[model samples]
Each structure stands twice: as structure tokens, then as C-alpha cells.
Target: MLKLSEIQRPIERELTIFEDKFKESMRSSVPLLDRITHYIVKRKGKQMRPMFVFFSAGSCGEINDATHRGAALVELLHTATLVHDDVVDNANVRRGFFSVNALWKNKVAVLVGDFLLAKGMQLSLANDDFGMLKIVSDAVQQIIEGELLQLEKARRMDIDESIYFEVIRQKTASLIASCCACGAASTGADDATVEQMRQFGEKVGMAFQIKDDLFDFGIDDVGKPLGNDIKEKKLTLPLIHALKQVGKPEKQRIINLVKNHNDDSQKVTEVIAFVKANGGMEYASSQMLAYQQEAFNILTHLPDNAYRHGLEQLVRYTTERNK
Candidate 1:
């Protein structure tokens, strides 16, 4: 496994350009919006999405202007979704800082999210990046549908493994798949290469989400509150697997606890213990590795280069990362 810094070294220059483009795209005439956007820029994450865009482009062909736009468009939509998610989750903290909704309240945050979304669309239209736009737009729609589906399942507490996969695929994997496909398309890669990268990204995204699901049960501080998913009634892979192994009565008891006492510290601890005891962690970990391997297999088809190596390291990192 390679360190993230080492993996990113291959595309550091491209990422720098992406950072500037991203910042410029977020600029607004409105003083408050500008301030909020600047705040967001200052506290941005590892730029993993844009890194994926650049690496995917480099793997298939040369990076070009369209690749930059693809990276910007993905980041714009991703940030907008995060803003809306904060409002929906009533989350005060994001990336260890106060979320936009926490600072400016729901009304401003909602508007800001809308503004970001429109800016992403405008970028695509202005550049006539319709191919990238279509990919991103489809991803956004799937993400919306995934969230709604998850919300519905969360309320019912009836999620199965298949449903869990579907939720994560739409909610998380679709965006990542679009990132790779857009990157490939931007470089004028053939349809076959674009599809291959899309598949690879989807597998990696699955592994990424599983790693995130594992964090809910981890002891280490993962930047967010532990058991946040459980509290939110989101049954992930581990818990879902554990449910399948239990007797009907035991499963019902677990479900009832999740429904009625999820917030209680003792109950959450008990649920976590039950999940671990039932081999939930092992099962989920194995599944995550399976997806990682699948992604690696797909990557083997692409022409090998430093970018491909970086992407391979990224797939490994997705499962191995503590956070």
C-alpha cells in the first residue's frame, strides 16, 4: 500500500490547477456567498474526487482543458450535496469545522447549496461539456434517489444486504463512476475505456462506503461521532449481515432496540457488541476486500502508467484508511 501523498505525487500539478479552477468557479458577487464559499475552500478535504478525475484521465490519455472542467464540475456537485446533507442531517460539524448550516442556519445553507448546483450546470453549459454534464446529471439523480430510498428504509428498519448495496451504489458509487467516466471522456478515450474506468470506480466506491460503514463501530475518533449511522437508523453492511445470522426473535429484539433505544448509550454499546460477536465486522471486511480486488482487476485492463498505479493505490487506500 502507498501513502496518499505518494499516490497523489503523480498528479500534483494537475490537482493544483484543479484547486484554482474550483476556487474561481465558486466565486460570487454576493458578499455573504463569497465569504461562505471562501470558508468552504479553506476547509476543503483531500481533493480525492479531483485526484480521481486526473488519474483516470491520465490513465486513458493526456489531460486537457476538458479534464479540468470535469474535475471542477464533480467537485461543485459534491460540495453542494454535502451542504444539503448537513442541513438534512442537522449536523453542526463537517470536516471538524462548523457546517454552513450550523453557521448561517438552514435558509442560507439551502440557498448556498442551490447556488453551487446551478454553478456546476452553468459550467458544463458554458463549455458545451454535455457528455460530462449528462454523466454528472445522471449521478446527481441517482444520488437523490438513493438518499430517498435510504431514508425510507431507515424509517422502516427493513433494509437487507441487497438494499444496502443498492443504496450505497446509487448514493456513493454513481458519483465516483461518473468521475472516472467523465475523466476518460474528457481525454477523448474510446467508449470501451470510459466504461472500464466507470466499472473500476464503482467497485472502488463500494469498498470506500464499506470502510465508512466500519467506522461506525470503530474505537478511534474518525472525525465524526461514533455510531452516527446507527443513531440515524441507517443499517449498514455489518449490521445487516449480523441480522441475517441471528434467530428471528433475536433479530426482532435488535431491530426494536435500534428503533426505540438507538440513542441510549448502553443500547448502542450492546448493539455494537452484538454485531461484532456475530462476525459482522469480518463479513463486511471480506466484502470490502472483494470489491477492492474487483476494482484492481478492472484497472489491469487499462494501459499501465504512474496514474494507473496511483489509482491502484487509491483502491487499496480506500479499504485500509482508518478514517
Candidate 2:
């Protein structure tokens, strides 16, 4: 029930410092690059990943210079991925704003993404934060692998619940897990504590993605258009579950719609109704709550404090967010 502002209260000052660090790290000499970067910075979404870093650091130990750098590193990598994703998805908007590619075109957006990635690496190398670098680097690899896996599955229309989980775990959860692990590492937390934080983050991330998938079925558009995932032929948990419950012919019908007629509004409406009738949304909601509870259980293992409370609120916020 805690508001986001309340959750951020404990680390308010640290977040300011992290913001300064992030802006400084992203500074560039090229005029176009600077303009685009400034626009990105200006239109940045809630710094959820950096908040994870600072909160996890505070939960394990005191925040320090290393924690600030860790926050910056994650943000930089996250921004890079988002820019690249906009191009890949042909997404014209992000977080309800015009995407980099929408304004500057794909070529500039891709180069800017690459530059951001390099800046992240340089930040880690300059500070000798190899541990942080490794965590983010592994996450980047997993994210790319997940995107490829999802693409492959979409092409074949063969993704099941297990494959769905794997895709979300890698594409979404891995980076959030890295946020917690790197935060704990920055504070010199023991390996056990770092692992615990990572597990907690992974569960929260799972819930986060489920909520996002649910948005695809919503009446009102969030940032992206409704059924955008369906248009892209990406079968999420709801559709996957619905497909499993139906008979072979009905299943094939759904698959055929997804495969051939995904762009058709009427077909998308039919698929959405089919999913609703088959308890797909209910099942996915249950799974999202399950992951949220699992994350809360992990939080119980951490010491009691405001930072721990912040993490708990974050779990709730992730599941409850409308957009």
C-alpha cells in the first residue's frame, strides 16, 4: 500500500547523487548526441532499476561511492537496451513519449545506443568495478539471448508456459536481479546476502513482466497500444495458458489467428476474448501474485529497516502498477 514516493524517501538523497552521476557519465561532445541524450534524460521513466540498486545496497550495508557507480552503470545499460529495443520493435513511443528512433531515426538511435553501452563499460572499467561489470555484462547477454529465443518462438508459434517463463526471466528478470546483486556487491555484502537479493529481484521482475503482459489486454492503452504484443506475434502467459486448455482444433485456430491474422483488429479481439473465456487472465494473475509473494518471503530474510520496507513496497508497486 506504500506509495512510490514513500518507498523512495529513504534513499532520496542518494538518488539525487546517482542522478548527477548518471548525467555526467552520459555527457557527449557530439551535438546531435547531446541533444538526443538530453531528451532521453528529460523523458526518463521512473528510475526503478537504480532505486533497486540503492535500496538493496542500503538493505545490505551503507550506501557509498560504489553504490552510486552501480546505479549509474545499470541505468546506462538499461537505457542502451531500451533504445535498441525501440528500433527492434519498431516502437515509435516509449513511456508515453516519442522514442529516440521516432525522432532521430533508427540509424542515429542505434549508434546512440552503442555509445551508451560503451559509456557504461568505461564507467565500470575506470572505477575498477569489475564485479559490477560482470553482473551487467552477463545480464546483457541473457537479455539478448532471451530476445532471440522469443523471436524464434514467435516465428514457430510454439512457446509454452515454461518457455514463457524462461523468456521473461532472461529478458526482463536478469537485469533486475543484476541490479540487486550489484548493489549488494557494491556494499561488500556477503555472497549469501547478494544471492538473496538477486532472488528477490528476480521474483519481483517476474511479477513486473506479468503485469506488463496484462496491460496488453486492457481497455485503455498504457504507453504502448493494446495488443501490441499480439501484433508482433509474441505469445505471453495469458495466451499460452489459454492455448493449453483448449482442444487441438481450437488451439490451432488461435495459433492460426496469431500467425496469419495478428494484424487484424477483429482477430486480435477474438483472441483476447478467447483468452478471457479460458481463464488465461486469471491464471496469469495468480502467477503474478505468486511471484510477488515469493519476493516478499525473500524480503523476510533480510534485516528489518526502511530499505527493506522500500523493497517490500516495490514488490507491491510492481504488481499493482497500471502502466
For 170-277, candidate 1 gives per-residue lDDT tens digits of 999999999999999999988888888888889989999999999898775444337767777789999999999989999999988888898987788888899999
Taken over the whole model, the C-alpha lDDT of each candidate is: 0.92, 0.92
The C-alpha TM-scores of every prediction are: 0.97, 0.97
lDDT by residue for model 2 over 87-206, one digit each (tens)?
A: 999999998899999999999999999999999999999999998899899999999999999999888888988999999999999999999999999999988888898898899999
Model 1 regions lying over 4 Å from their true place = 222-225
Q: Candidate 1: which pairs clash?
A: none
The TM-score of candidate 1 is 0.97
